[model samples]
Target: MEISAATMDDALHKALGKIIKSKKAISLDSTKGSNRELVGVQIRISDPRARFSRAISRSQLFSSLGELFWYWGGSNRLDQISYYVKNYRQESEDGLTVPSAYGPRLFALRGKNQIDGIVNLLREKPTTRRAVIQLYDAEDLDSALSPPCTCTLQFLMRQGKLNLFVSMRSNDILFGFPHDVFAFTMIQEIISRRTGVELGEYIHSVGSLHLYANQQSKAQNYLAEGYQEKVPMPAMPEEDPSAAMLVLVRYEREVRLNQTLPAFPCGLADYWLDLARLLAIYKCYKKKDRETIEKLKNKMSASVYEQAISKRAGQIKWQTIRQEPLNFTSQD
Candidate 1:
């Protein structure tokens, strides 16, 4: 079945509603876990930029950013990703790296840069259908662990806009769907900037779109919360965003390492600077320093991130208070 929506939340709500009620869905058990699986699902997001959802149940913004930077950096190390989402350690084979991580495949598969190749291909011929990035390799079958769920990403330039079509072998709707949309659509925007075109629709095709038994309750909670406003992220500057992206990546590494925040005048636009400040905010959150988090948050220019950042700050404050020792000897 196909679902078309204007934003990620809209699409997610529609897809979840269908999965919960569709008689065609089957209960299945796999090596991963038990889930209700639906085959051949296609979701098209009309506004690719409105990728984020304000669903409090999911709390996906932080982890989504982590996944995006992880993939963009072409990293497979477990330590790097586990810091953002602890559950990623479960996917690691040797407790060191995740072979199925798409970073290595997307950026450097057999020393061939598929991202660059796609950019070059599209720049040469806007209408070409060969601008494909292959993620699932033949050797993945030999591995003991599961292969990448995302098999391929195809980009098409039409009507002065760049569109992305993605095919996934499997998808955990409640878990994987949101992050995949955020990252892939960001890539689409990046490619559009590089190719000098407007951002277009995102088509996600999944062979198996399933919601695990463990996440069913959370999914229902998301649905119960009802509709949220569609807030699109800031547009990438018309100029080539590669340099700013590199700066963001570099600052991200520093922030993840708990290093000092880079000084201002780092030569990034306000758009990129706001993103860099978010990493700083995340750093402060990791340190459990609510004071610095608030300070960094105040510096952020993007209001789209305010809710998520505020929520995170509140969590850190609560955690700090909970961890503090309380004295009750006098009362006792």
Candidate 2:
């Protein structure tokens, strides 16, 4: 379920065609320095997973509003948003501790109640459907620090394939378009997995996709170089029992880390301490080379020893050790 850059280019080309045929006059915004003008078609693609569908819809131009809010709004401590949207609320009860103020604006736009919307959608439509959540709130745009998007997203389900269509008011071809391509595609993959649907085409309809005056050189360079038409998608997981085991192992490790880490610690020192311990264990298990493992072990042991000696040192808590057999494959 990986997306290729060529697929992205093809979608962009299709969007350009739509815009040209429509004969729309796209406004170019250059308020920001460095000639950031809107150009090119805006498109979205989606599958079943509601959060994933929403992510694919918005990730194209700007990292999904959820992403912006998560990173900027200090809500990354837990996967509350993802859990809520995915209907795993029982498993994510810990997330209820997150303040309502931290919720992203898009959540409301999706529905009055995020969890209910997702659950109802899932129950009624067990099959994969193209579900979209939008964030261009008129009230927010009018009073906000930033302007809302002129274009809106529509998710379509056709023949069990999820397709995304974005109608953008403005497009900054050089700067903004690439983000839209990668983010939406990733969203496509996540939804595909959750809903058991194949990702089809991403349709973009751009009103104005332009390069700013200052970006002429950069645009020229891009035009001259031409985009590489094909990029390889990551290999899909194999269906063999052994392959399943590997995926399970990875998931288990992720769960362990998730459960143990404190809800987003404050600063670098705290982050480093946790990271050091995690890396040490991960490196020990993943690194096959004895030499590499030994080196990591020595470094980690020294760091732990130093911390123990420090006057500011607090309680050193270590979890019980569980060893799993390692299985290697050419894919690894």
Clashing pairs in 1: none
The numbered model that scores best in TM-score is 1
lDDT of each: 0.85, 0.38
Off by over 4 Å in 2: 1-6, 10-30, 33-103, 106-123, 126-130, 235-332
lDDT of 2 by residue, 77-143 (tens): 3453342133223223355532222234334444454323433453367443535444445564443
TM-score of each: 0.93, 0.46
Instruction: Give the per-residue Cα lDDT of candidate 2 at 222.
Output: 42
Give every collision pair in model 2: 38-171, 39-171, 39-172, 39-209, 39-210, 40-209, 41-206, 44-164, 60-180
TM-score of 2: 0.46
* CA lDDT, candidate 2, residue 98: 29
